[model samples]
Target chain A: MTAAVRRRAGLRELGLGLALPFVLVVIWEAAGRAGVVPQGILPAPSLVAAAWRDWAFADPGLGLNPYLGTWGETVLFSARRVFTGFVCAILIGVPMGIMIGWNRMVAGAVDPLIQSLRPIPITAWLPFAIAVFGIRDAGAVFLIALGAFFPIVVNATAGARDVPRNLIRAARMMGANERQLLLRVVLPAALPNIFTGMRLGLGIAWTAVIVAEIVAVKSGLGYVLWDAYYVGRMDVVIADMVSIGIAGFLSDRVLVAVQLRVLHWKQAVRA
Target chain B: MTDAVAIRGLRKVFEGRAGAVEALAAIDMTLAEGEFACILGPSGCGKSTLLNVIAGFEAPTEGSASVFGAPVSAPGPDRAVVFQEASLFPWLSVRDNVTFGPRMLGRPKDETDALARRFLDLVGLSGFEHHLPDQLSGGMKQRVGIARCLILNPRVYLMDEPFGALDAQTRMQMQELLTHVWDQARGTVLFITHDIDEAIFLADTVYVMTARPGRMRSRIAIELPRPRSIDLLTDPRFNALRADILRQIREEAIKAMAEEERARR
Candidate 1:
């Protein structure tokens, strides 16, 4: 197909994505204005937008609402938790994956246990998390880290294992020692797979953050979501829900941007 | 003359799901120093298996092979292999791939860079040093593969159908480039191919192999003079050698198949 035609097709998809949300907002606002439903149970999109604005910009003389103008802090709290957990997952997961993939002994000893433990949901560990860390940030952080770690480790291991045997032999023929082979050859070969794992793990981290905030500690978008749901502030609850979505979308977009940069070489090959 | 590569009664057997499959049978051969030897055969003739044994990537289940009088055991930098697939590390830059051996062996950066640059230029990839393997075409990746091994300055070049995957034009071009490179370097080359024409064009001595349970059926010495050109392809002498090798390979392949059928019965 012509480049122009392809680009126009892509633009159409983007436009649809942008327009659908606005249409949903308008419909919800109209529903509330006409009073077609009970207002206490569900807030209009307009009301959510106003609460979002208040939380974001903190309008003049906002009274007794600690949430006003504090969107950045709440965002930062969740972002930090995700970031710390994600980094920890990568650091531990990558090396562990390499060892497990490269050595049969390591795989036999460690892979089976990790695979078995992986089936247990991160939410299932909430009680144990709170019991050990005692309702602190560490408990939330632990949950986030645990949640993100599984996918990263598993993907990294498979990636490393999938590296071509010829490439390894070539490396050895080039006088690469075991350490250099692992670092220079195996690590880079496994990067694309590892990045795939990281993206998956980061998504899990966000989910774990919401779960942790709902129970383990009282902070972040998840905490705000739960807190606003109580006392019947449906507008704030809707706004908090939107905030979580935006955070997740933005986080994923950041990852895709990095993936584009790291995998640009791969693109031309396909082209 | 000292034999650069010596294979005396070298045998290899692979244990399969059914039983022991003999990949090579008492394969005894030797290449004189700086000779260009082509191992020619049909598919499943174990030509690659033989190359791998000499390359030290596989151990012979029965006999032994040696390189430069040293017992072949494991892969080492002294011998370089060019695989059918480029088999390059995709993440490394072309220059980095070429310099990989030297850098891994702790050669000085200046020396390695200079050597890499020379080989890249030699392979006509001078302008594409910083490019990743994925960025290059299949032919270019193969060139980088050759350059990487060339930069290592290995004594023996064990190539297992390195250009077999390329299109006709690219394959011809690679063949010419290889001859040019070999002329300059003058290293021992053990080139393997299923193509009779390729064998006739490139090898000084063509060692024809029998199909599975591969043995060296015969060796044909090509007296075709050096500084060979593509024009030689149409020459009557070239066609004669090609026909002889093809006929020999076809007969061997038929015999191999009959043997297989007999065993089944």
Candidate 2:
């Protein structure tokens, strides 16, 4: 209840969360050092951290290592793609979804097409993406956008559709024209759902960027991940995987912060 | 002079999987300008459906509802509604919800804000302007609902059991608040409720409806004095009006229950 008590509770939760991963890493390190685990296949946490440090902070002139001093750029490349693709997904999805949910004609015309195409995985589009965009960043962006679009649109539709009937009537009775009703009432009402879709879409966007990077492009964490593994630099591969996880987690946190700001009333309702 | 609200042979039917369910068979009513009328009925007596028709939320199957001689074709700010659940935009603060109608009508912000303040104050929600609907109690939310409609300065107010969900004490307080508000704003109101006390306390005229296939059973004029308060609840005349309306509603409620039991069998 008190601020001090709350802070202590938060600290305890953090410590508990870290304890299991810390113990796991310690056991893993012990197994590696004792030669009970093969180091070539899976390196210790220390090795991954050391390799990540070099990849992040090492002087570029010191060695022929391709990963030297490239961690930030590699992450930026993947992050930028995810950001652009996710934005595109939101731009196309939210309006399309609102329309589909709000109007029967739009739903009839477009929903079936989206539903049918949604079953096709992003991986399935890889060949087509490479063929059309020809291994460029555009191909990666296209795949990421397409991959993230489904969840965003689907959740947006659900959000828009589930608006309370009374709220609609209340808006109409308040003299809100159709456009004003949708923008002022329906949109705000569906915002909690829109955020839900965006979070799911962002996760998919990260997946999409990696898939795009691994096959269709050359400069992101995904590219380095595959490149490192081929050369048996499992340390770099593991570090890249950790970086992707951290990036994805951080992006999700940013979205959650925005959601909290926008849907504070929704949170109060739930509380 | 055109009546504030006029309905003639209004009928509503729902074509469900079970076939056509007649909600309102035939209903007729009229309210003079600035009159406060209450429709008291048993549950499922098409009382809300009647309000919905008048509010332009639902179309009548067989007849017409008009406001100030204009056929009700669509919902508009001229006929504001205070729903049973209060239906305040959950995302909006009390101030925002109260201002919603005026804002939607493109009224000047300063004018709307002042109106919102006055109405919210009228309902005793002046300090709670920043509170969301979720944060407010049932009575407080209903106050916001009343304030929002009052802010519109509508010709008619269609309320569908606005205090039905509140506790007995809160409901009484709300009824008093509403009467106090009506004294200030003075719009024609068609309030729907099942409570005999609420009807007697608030209405200039009370229209009691019968069970399913609901039709207007009786119309009782409450000759109670203006600016009525909770003190009026214990008045001898108030008790007499309550007893009279209670008997009619009780008969309808029994019929509704019997119909339900027969349908179940």
**Going through the candidates in order, what is chain B's TM-score?**
0.97, 0.95
Alpha-carbon runs more than 4 Å astray in model 1: A1-10, A59-64, B263-265
The digit string of per-residue lDDT tens for model 2 on A83-199 reads: 999999999999999989999999999999999999999999999999999979999999999988999999889989999999999999988999998999888888888899999
Model 2, B17-84: lDDT tens per residue? 98999999978888999889999888888889898888888889999999999999989989989988
Among these predicted structures, which one has the highest lDDT?
A: 2
DockQ of each: 0.69, 0.74
Distance (Å) between predicted and true CA of A254, model 1? 1.1
- lDDT of candidate 1 over B80-139, digit per residue (tens): 999999999887788888899999989998999899889988888888988889888889
Error of 1 at B229 (Å): 1.7
Compared with the true structure, what per-residue lDDT tens digits does model 1 show for residues A1-271?
A: 9999999999999999989888877887798889986677788876778888988888435446756887778889989998888888888999999889888999999999999999999999999999999988998888988888899899889988999999999999888989998998888788888898988999899999999998988888888888878867788888888788888899989999998888776665645
Q: Is the docking of candidate 2 incorrect, acceptable, medium or high quality?
A: medium
Task: For each candidate, report what fraction of the true interface contacts it reproduces.
Answer: 0.83, 0.92
**Model 2 lDDT at residue B29:** 83
lDDT of 2 at B265: 100
